[model samples]
Target: MIRHDTPSLMLLWSLLALSQAASAAPDTELTPIEVTASPIPSVAPLEGQDYSASRVDADGLAVFGGPAQANPYRALDLMPSVNLTGVDAYGLSVDQNAMRVRGIAASTYSNLAVTVNGTPSSVSAGRGGVGNLFDMENLESVTLWRGAQPADVGLGMGNLAGSLDLAIKGPTEEAGARLRTSVGGDGFHKLFGRIDTGTFNGGSSLFVSGSTSESDKWRGEGGQSRDTFNAGFAQTFGERGSLEIYAAHNRFHRDEYRPLTYAQSRDLDRYADLDYNADLTGVATTDADYYAYNSQHFDETNLLARFSWALTDDIQIRFSPYWLSNEGERRVGKTDKVMVIDIDQEQYGATAELVAELADQTLTLGYWTQRLSSMPPPMSQKVYAIDKQGGLVFSKWGILADMGDRAYESPYLQLSGERGRWRYGIGLRYLSFRIPGITSYDGSGLPNMSHDSALSMNPAVVAALSTDAVTLDEWLPTLSSRFELTPALDLKGAYGRSVGNPWMGPLYSVYMKNRKAFQKAGIPLQQLWDDLALETSDTIELGLEWRHGSLVLTPTLYYSDLSDKQVTAYDPAVGVSYLQSGVDAKAYGAELEASWGLDRHWTLIGSLSWNRNRLDDDIRAGSAAVLETSGNQVPDAPEWLAKLGAEFRYGNWNLTPIARYVGRRYGDALNQESVDDYATVDLNAVYRLGKVAGMQSLEIGMSVVNLFDADYISTIDVGQDDARPESIDYYPGAPRTLALSLSANF
Candidate 1:
């Protein structure tokens, strides 16, 4: 009999007490960690090569043993608490990216709230919402929190489900390098390399990794492909001191729909059956008949440093400085009717923290400050367009504007630790935002003609804010607790009044558009671009965790009450959408995750998360705020998401299979029409042969995706057709895919 007694569970009673100590640092994602598993693996490389290289080696991971599919998000979406916004297994979209979590995405561009070795990724295209989160070449281990979370998250607004944390591989042990290549269907090809050296004394050697990938689109007129480059290096100064550096550059190009219709999607998909999808795309994209086209070029760079020193056994100090920069430009064909952006963000902070273990309790304290600033684009050009048949006419309207410059400072504190059977945490935070004139535009470049998208042609679109308040300021408080119930079980709970200032992304502000654009006259002019606002919410979560040998289970329940819930809506007249109206809403959910470590030869893991959110009221028409979600489930939020998988290893052979499930959702919030539910099963296998007499280490693997060849819609959204007839829109999934790769280590 297992007695759920306090004394019997004391050792397993790990408590996290909250603190307001200036010594605090940002909390990371909750990646279900199996301490019993082998420590993160690392290896060395050939001499004269860039050492300090390590790989999570997604290639060899049993999950990807099969071929690549449309779901580029892949294992990233299967991790605990992880969810996707625009991802559906084998969906219509080839990119199959664009994501959100909890209930919202980090920004419109789908930038995830990511921390690479404790450094936040830059989301500003040019001082605001503009890019993606990762380059497979630079990724180490991305730990996903998947939903309800701790405070100190979200550079701006966030989702209701979960979060993800990415740890770019750094110097671990030995010194080594690697080079690999692979080619697959649809013109898919990948090449990459890496090297790393273990930590040196209090300091470690450096490491670097980079890769490039390109693939042809399987549908539409013009296909698409992309290239990315990444590099990372890190080392420590003393036992408590360290330095990490990283940088990335990406260039992307894609053809427009070439007038492809929603109905024709299935026709293009049919090409997959004949093994000629990519070929069809390549043929349709010739210069003679090419009509519409879009291509975007983006560049990003980042740098960070963290240093800590132990003044005493119970006290320590830490400091960090980070800088990021990004710039992007987009154009349709040869027209200068382009969108340009440039952003540079930086942060510097210092902290003093104490961890004192007393006879009866442990105490913690800390404090810190930070500052952020943004700058709009530089000199720009407005071009006019004239088509032979006037089919798709474009012209520069006039007066380009820029979102004004602004910056802010924040101070924070916290206290947490364990005292006997009780562990508690409490903290406070405050921020200030300053913007003299949030919207600034030049009244130049007006073409002498009329166009529907005039305002959009201005190239420089700024958020509309008419506030005399030089600074937006706010304060917040939080609390948390945990208790050990039995040696094999523990209970934890947390509540906090957390507030987020809008980011330069999905979060919007109300604005007016030009008549003849997408709106009617007399519409309010509340330009909705990303803005700064205070979002306060109370969150509570309870968890029951258990561990037996290598078997582990964690069941969690949570609720969130949001005040001024920032929702995004679109406008027509101004040709814009903004984060304007917010209402009261509550989100509650439960998640169960378990992994049974049967034996070295057999093990199983599975997880499921469910959430329900209710809006307090409905949104009005054309404020560009169309939730259309009256009395229906929230868009992009599914009710139930689950996954299960099992793996068995024998001698040098391994076999595994996985199943994924996604519940149905309404095409619109009103729930008038519903999308059917879907599920997928995949298979994988790997055989590791001992090194050849003259060879070091070598491996080969095979993977199959969407083994069943099922057709399913992963996402559906509110859309309107000609005459503005309200309708739902959906993105199709990719067809089944297969991949095989061979690798060696020397």
Candidate 2:
């Protein structure tokens, strides 16, 4: 349950502790501390790193228009080789947004890993990261590492592309409080507040924050609301060590929206709701609205504990342990035969690192281990039937499906060292997964046989039964190096191999639903199992970085080869869907980013990326027809992306203007349907009032998005083979919108 008084209680407890510590300590003069840099640094490339990485600090984040509901990931859209869709004026709704790295598809984020304070945030069931759980108002920095990840970071299972890391802000040296409130278009309103407790005599500090936001749907009938709370405490144990603990809780609810077809968008109203259909029996005709009943609810909580100690003068050790839990439910479709999904998951992990100072080199060794268990039960219920008067009649309840227990154990080791101007690293990981049980209802609304009867009935059933735990393992390795030839120039290269495990949902569905059905239709179970394999990839890249007095430039070229790419196929003969490990695929790309200080008060930033991806061979379709997809562009993979922005600051005011462009893209593997290129512009301004009235700080900001009201497709449902205009699968982009916000700190 969401508690509005939780933040207040936490703040009260922190103050009480602070008072006691102060009363018990001696009266000693406080030492003065020197500050060298701003609390948040500007966006910059990582020096002495072999791979491509970019860091955006708090100041850098402000350049992205300072939306009321800030989303750190949205700021990465300006970076090279990154694509984002469905972003609104506030840059919120991370779950609704789709993010793509390089030429990879956005349906699943298994290729990318996301972390907060070294804790893994991605769901164990391949549903991307827990982005909605984070309180963006408390973030200090967000870093994006493209391509290969560092050896010491091993908190994810399937990280073939790279990782995104977010760090939270630390407590201030002096006690302070901040509050921000905003109202904008679409009935949008938000309230955010934070409190910081300065260090006490015992060298301890704490901070607590909370936020609540709600907004009406921009182009639909429904809306969304969210509540979040975050807290952190740190204690110092003299110069030997320190301990820090952080926790966050989030509750989110939203109504799902139905996508529109091209014909509906062009002929009917762009925001029309056509999600109503007649009953199957044709006995009573009433409004069976899909959108009216479609909704989702999520609750997530996370806790992390970090401990550091200097074992000796030459050695230091750090240990971090984290725990996370999530509970969610999604309801969709008609009221009569509504589909409901309940997911419950719990995960815990720890990472230990040791740094040793050696002659001419610094050696680092680390180990990471984590365990996850999840239970997802899906059911379809005939709650009620629609009547002629748009009323409902009651019906019976029955179970549809259930997955008993899913678990994973991941462990990895990392070793790296730096000597002089050359640096190198290596890493290895082993991943294991298991699923224990499953249950599904039959056509007559009766429960199927249990594990004993089902296994005895058919020998093949024994191998496919979910009750029999199955385990799969894989080993991953990576190597990278960097060379600094001059003070202003550096060369880097890396080779990495990564793996993507098959998702448990698809695996359970295929084994429980398709295996028996296919066997009844004369297909062997062994053939089905053999067709599924783990997805693997090998990537190689070379990069160059050149820095001048007031300008920084980086260009990188990379190539990747993928094998055993998992794809879904339908068997016409058996009327069942199954997974197939298709042939090899390849992708090559180039990315360039440049930042220049036009003058003392102005800065220019630009980025450009080009990439191509294609399959290496042809495959047979459901109708037993050979489709020549070799050398054809991958579905939904755009060819070009560009971004440019300029920032100007004078006195207490700053203004920013930004533009983005995306080239044409194919919607199908056969390149039959396509969407045209589009561009957008945005402008933002902020004014700061220092020590206004009795307040320590005050600021106001406004942003305008889609300045020209461009009409284009923001995203598309790929795999469409037809060329009919009505069959075009696309999601229309948002129109022009404006937002304003005000904040005060005391």
Which candidate has the top score in lDDT?
2
**lDDT (Cα, tens digit) per residue for candidate 2, span 518-544:** 767876544444444556778888988
Off by over 4 Å in 2: 1-41, 106-109, 122-131, 262-288, 334-336, 375-410, 435-467, 507-516, 521-532, 570-577, 717-729
Clashing residue pair totals per candidate (backbone < 3 A): 87, 0
- Candidate 2 has a TM-score of 0.85
Q: What does the lDDT come to for candidate 1?
A: 0.46
- Candidate 2: residue 696 Cα off by (Å): 2.1
Query: For model 2, how big is the CA root-mean-square deviation?
Result: 6.4
| Best candidate, TM-score | 2
Q: Candidate 2, residue 528: CA error in Å? A: 4.9
Looking at candidate 1, the ten consecutive residues that score lowest on lDDT are 44-53
